[model samples]
Target: MIHSHVPVSDLREHIGRTVSVRGWVHTLRLQRAMQFVVVRDGTGLVQVTNRRDGGPLEALIEALTPESAVRITGRVVDAAQVRLGGLELVPETVEVLNPAATPLPIDDRTGPEQRLDWRYLDVRRRPAARLLFAVQTTLEQGMREYAYAQGATEMHTPKLMGTASESGAEVFELGYFGRSAYLAQSPQFFKQMAVAAGIEKVFEIGPVFRAEPSFTSRHATEFTGVDVELAWIDGVEDVMAFEERMLAHAIAKVADLHGEAVAEHFGVRITVPTTPFPRITMAEAQEILRSAGWDPSGTKEDLDPEGERSVSAHMREATGHEFVFITHYPVGLRPFYHMRAADDPGLTLSFDLLWNGLEVTTGAQREHRYDVLLAQAAEKGLRPEPMQDYLNAFRHGCPPHGGLGMGLARVLMVLLGLGSIREATFLFRGPNRLTP
Candidate 1:
């Protein structure tokens, strides 16, 4: 309630009238006869004119500093010569509300690491960060609407687990009162359980943890996850089609709402990708790579980063699309839960959703049959003793289901053309970064 002044963004509606404006000083220009101070109030910016009239106003303007919070009583005036909105304010009084420290630690030229050290200040200085969050909000909202429309129930899956909830290798273990516990790597088991409980469809947006020591720009120890599961799927293609539709809707909404601002700030145009994102089976992808003379280091069951980029590039050249769904990966390259294709037992009904060069999502039609799931787990050298609770869900009558998890930060980074996932994350947590 302390900032009772009218918002700067609405100033155009009150032109030629006296009003009070509150915000931090963005910049100040001093002259012998007149003074100009641009105030930013998060919503917008207004230029305040403090004319020298043989009073204490000159001293007040001289004392003004950038980022200093102030309140100004001014009359809005439109000057054709002025650049910013062709409007400025002529202040009758200026009062310092709060003074910011002089010589900011970060600036426009500051590097990413140092800027992160002072994130709040960095966000205030860069309009791109503001637009990034705005786009993110719209993106999440769109997904929520689409999921609900598809008869999907939203959920808040637990973060704590009795055992490794996923990827047994890279999981965060913590000490409980007298026992040991681990963080939920993904809401995989729960989402599948929801389907087994006859929810039909479910989606969750929450944080997931990974204990890997990867230092890649794309990997984060903790990141927001967008997970979805649907029961009674005809095939893995159903899940892939649902995801493409969801992404297209979200991107279209983001473009409709903030396209102009995004373009102005990030120099990138938002394109709502068309449906049926080009799909190439894993065998075909590897063959293409082999034809191109790509030799991955070691005999890898999965596509390396370079191979992903090359396939994505090929997809773009061949189909003129940014998204490519690499499907039917070998069983060794997928999780034990993925259902192997009935025709070919060696390849699973799984997919990796690649955007521009990075894999943003991995989805599959899960093995809903109890016997099949347990057998697949055993084949992968997994002990079913620890995963009994998860297995129990399928044991008590389950529906045919499948789902996928998409990285929120990764999608945002690729959409905005940001070079790294760190740019999309508000407070990035990686192997080395645990502080603001």
Candidate 2:
């Protein structure tokens, strides 16, 4: 019987011993008297050398193709001339499990769309792609650890809702038992419901759906959202403080774990951001952009992409920080649930966190008082009957709470200096592209 397969990365420990290596054939070099086969596994690659003797093994080696699944019984040896870690495997037998077809659909020269069409094959061939996911995993893990330490409970809210959770124009509605049901745009309402249910601190990392026809590099129809809610918050500042600390913790974890790999593969140096990230009010941001020669063609109260980039650039230059919170947005630009600022009823106690010139988070203190919520909804021209159930959460008794929804892919994109959200996501779902 063939021996159990050993990972290519573990070959160093088994030198001077017979072993079985299993992986896809990365490359094959055939000569008149010798053949060199480089096998690639998830961990690393190993080079195998075989001397030609007109044997059955020679035919199997000749028939092997790149990326073919195979198991090779071999003796591990330390060869000074070998390039791959100075180690080579001398094969005693070769077994081809599955041979890949010739002329792969994608290659190093393939464009983005074609590469995405064969995502699995493309990911297998790129080391940097693998490292991007590793950093993402560590980032999520660090965030979860910090949340748990802060007495936060993890939650999974329903993706289907009877009413459009946010804007009806951006919701995906379908018939459910003859009644229309909508895909949840955010876990905003349910997270508040959890707060009213006495689960004061809660967090959810789940898929969010948006029916936006945006073709920008940062927009996706379906993406992962990192959400958090905390009750008994004094103001929006509490929410911002929690988010900044949590993010710093998670980023530090990524920097600690995969700093070298990220630097090597993506050429990015991960830095753990300092606490109390620079904060500038929305009015201040617009003024800063205007001073920098920003065009005022768009809305005067809100910062467009160019305005956001200008503000981020200014903060980075002034404070040497990568993250800045733009706060106190006008009421017209915020949702009805966002609590209006007491000092200025025309503005909401809300903030947007911008990292590397991209807005990744929007958070605010929610108006928990039932009467104020209804009045705000009416002011926005929204009828209260369809949202009575949500209103009931606040009608009874709910603490003053606030939270933030963060775009997972956007964070990953900025962290690794990725050009687009598609590169950071595992299976990108966009306006025109859906399949793997």
Candidate 3:
């Protein structure tokens, strides 16, 4: 009977016992008298040594190559001189389950596009790739834990919509049955509907689609979105406060769990940010950017990428914090659903959260009054016929509510200091590339 394979990480517990280790060859070192094969399972790596005499074991070791999946039956032993876990596996039998092909398509020097073409191989060869997903899993878990503790219900809204969800120009249209259907751009309307139905506090982590053909480092055709909505808030500040606390809690958990691994793998230090992250109005942010030698005269209503980085840097210097929320955007720049400031009708109670010089989140207090919502939609040249159901939610009776939509990949990218969203995502989808 064949024994179940043990993970390389647990080999220390079974010292001196004959066990079967199943994994891929990490490295193969052949000398005149001995052969050393380093095997790697996802848990860890173990060195398997065999004598290079004229025997079948040596012949099998000679035939093995890097990344070849194999089942190695060996006895675990302590080796004080060895660097990897202070242990080694003495091979008694070998089984080559699957041998890798000669001449791999990717390596350390391979370009980004080709490496993405062969992403599975690239991830197996690079430790950072595995670490990246592991961090993502932990990050999501931390956020979910915080949300659940806060009495928030997790919901999964439909992705297919009867009409274009938002920004009609960027909607991906498809044929449904006999008419046209659109991919839900954001759960904005449905989340609001949940609030109207008395779900009070809710959140969703799901895929968001964008039809824009942007090829920027931060842009992607499809990505994961972390969304949250709350009802009966006193003002937009309540939303901001909730977000800051949620993020702080999540970051602290990540730091506790994967901080050291992140530092070792990506050279990034995870700092748990203080609550009530620094807040600055949009006009004030522009002023700060101008003072920092960045001319933003060409863009008044919105901040460009350079302007975001400049303001973030300024805030970091002034507040000793990496996160800053630029708030009170001009009404024209935001969507019609955002609530208008009572003191200034031209500005909306909205904000964009910047982390480490990147725009990671956009949130606002939504206009829940039915009459005001209709007028705002009309002013923006939006016909009420297409999104009538969304408008009807406010007509009956809805409490004051607000929410935010955060880009998950963008957060991960900034967290790991990766060059692009492509590097952060498991399988990136863009305009130019689609297959594996």
Candidate 4:
């Protein structure tokens, strides 16, 4: 009987045992009398060696190519010659499950644009791609752990909606049963509905669609958003603290499990940020930027890409921190949903979390008063009649709450110093990219 086992790198006490492994050929090195074929099983790579027999082994070697799926029976051997785990598999039998076509469209040495065009082939060689996904899994698990501990309920909101949550940004409009429907830009309204429904703390991890047309490396048409809203919060600080702990836990977990791989592949160490990530008001960040010879063009509300880069560099140099919270945005710049500060009333209680010169999250205290919310919506030139359902939540005893929406791909991109957000996402959908 063929004993089923994973690759040698993932094998622990099962070494030196005969096992049946199935995977695709990653690399093939042939010598005069013997052949070394490296097979990848998604978990890891295992080196398999074959004797110079002019039978199945020879035929397999002759027909082998990258991405050819195969099943083999071999005895795991402890050998120092192999690069992975100091163990190799000596294959006694071989079966070609599927043969690959020659001349791949893209390879390991392909350029970024070409690789993106053929992402499947690119992902096959990119160790960083695998590491990014592993980190994402760890981060999501960490979020769930922290939320569960904090009494937050997990909710899956509808992706299709009748109207936009925030009246500002562009949305992808589609005909849903012959009515004007849009892909949900966020779980904002639904989460607030949960608060009105009396489910206090809530969180959702899901896809958000945007029709943004910029070709910036940080922006994407569709991306995963990590969001959480807490009911009965005093202010935005409570939500900020929750986010900080969540991030710290996720970073620590990822570093512990895949730190070495991250370093080797991405050339950066994952640092679990300390509590209370440097909070600087938007005005202060702008002043800091000016001190660093970056004139933000007198825009106190938002940071242009160059301004973001300069401020991030300054923060890293001065405080040795990659994450920074820029808070108290000008009320004019924020959406109608943002709760204005009680003391100032000119600035909203909103914050953007910047990691390595890129914005990964936008969070704020939401306006919970019915009249105030409606006034803000009208002031922002939005029709309050269309938002009657949403406004009703505030009227029916909605708690004082705040939340943040974080872009998962943007976080991964900045953390790993990837050139584009697309590099960090699997099956990326953008304004230009639609299919495989």
Scored by lDDT, the top model is: 2
What TM-score would each prediction reach against the true structure? 0.96, 0.98, 0.97, 0.94
Off by over 4 Å in 4: 10-16, 78-87, 298-300
Model 4 whole-model lDDT (C-alpha atoms): 0.85
Q: Write the per-residue lDDT of candidate 3 for residues 246-329, one digit (tens) a residue.
A: 888888888898899899999999999988799999999989977778775566659999888989999999999999999999
Worst 10 residues of 2 by lDDT: 292-301
- Between candidates 1 and 3, name the one with more favorable lDDT: 3
| Model 1 regions lying over 4 Å from their true place | 1-4
TM-score of 3: 0.97
In model 3, the clashing pairs are none
- Give each model's whole-structure lDDT: 0.90, 0.92, 0.91, 0.85
Q: Which residue window of length 10 is worst by lDDT in model 4? A: 5-14
Per-residue lDDT tens digits for candidate 1, residues 1-436, read 1323689889888889888998889998998898999999878888888778878877887899899989988889987787777789998778999888988898788899888888888888788998899899999999998998898999888899998854588898899999989999999999998898889999999999988899888999999999999999899999999999999999999999999999999999988899989999988998889889987658776998899999999889999999999999998888899999999999999999999989999999999999998999998888999999999999988999999999999999999999888899998898899988
Clashes of 4: 0
On the 0 to 100 scale, the lDDT of residue 312 in model 3 is 95
Q: Please give, for residues 1-436, the per-residue lDDT of candidate 2 as tens digits.
A: 6576788888889988889988888888999999999998888889999999999999999999888999899899999898899999999989899999987788789999889999998888888998888889999999999899999999999999998865577888899999999989999999999999999899999999999999999999999999999999988899999999999999999999999989999899998999999999998988898788876775566887878888998999999999999999999999999999887999999999999899999999999999999999999999998888889999778999999999999999999999999999988999898897
Candidate 3 residue-wise lDDT at 244: 86
lDDT of 1 at 96: 97
lDDT of 3 at 347: 96
Q: After superposition, how far is residue 321 of candidate 2 from its true place, in Å?
A: 0.6
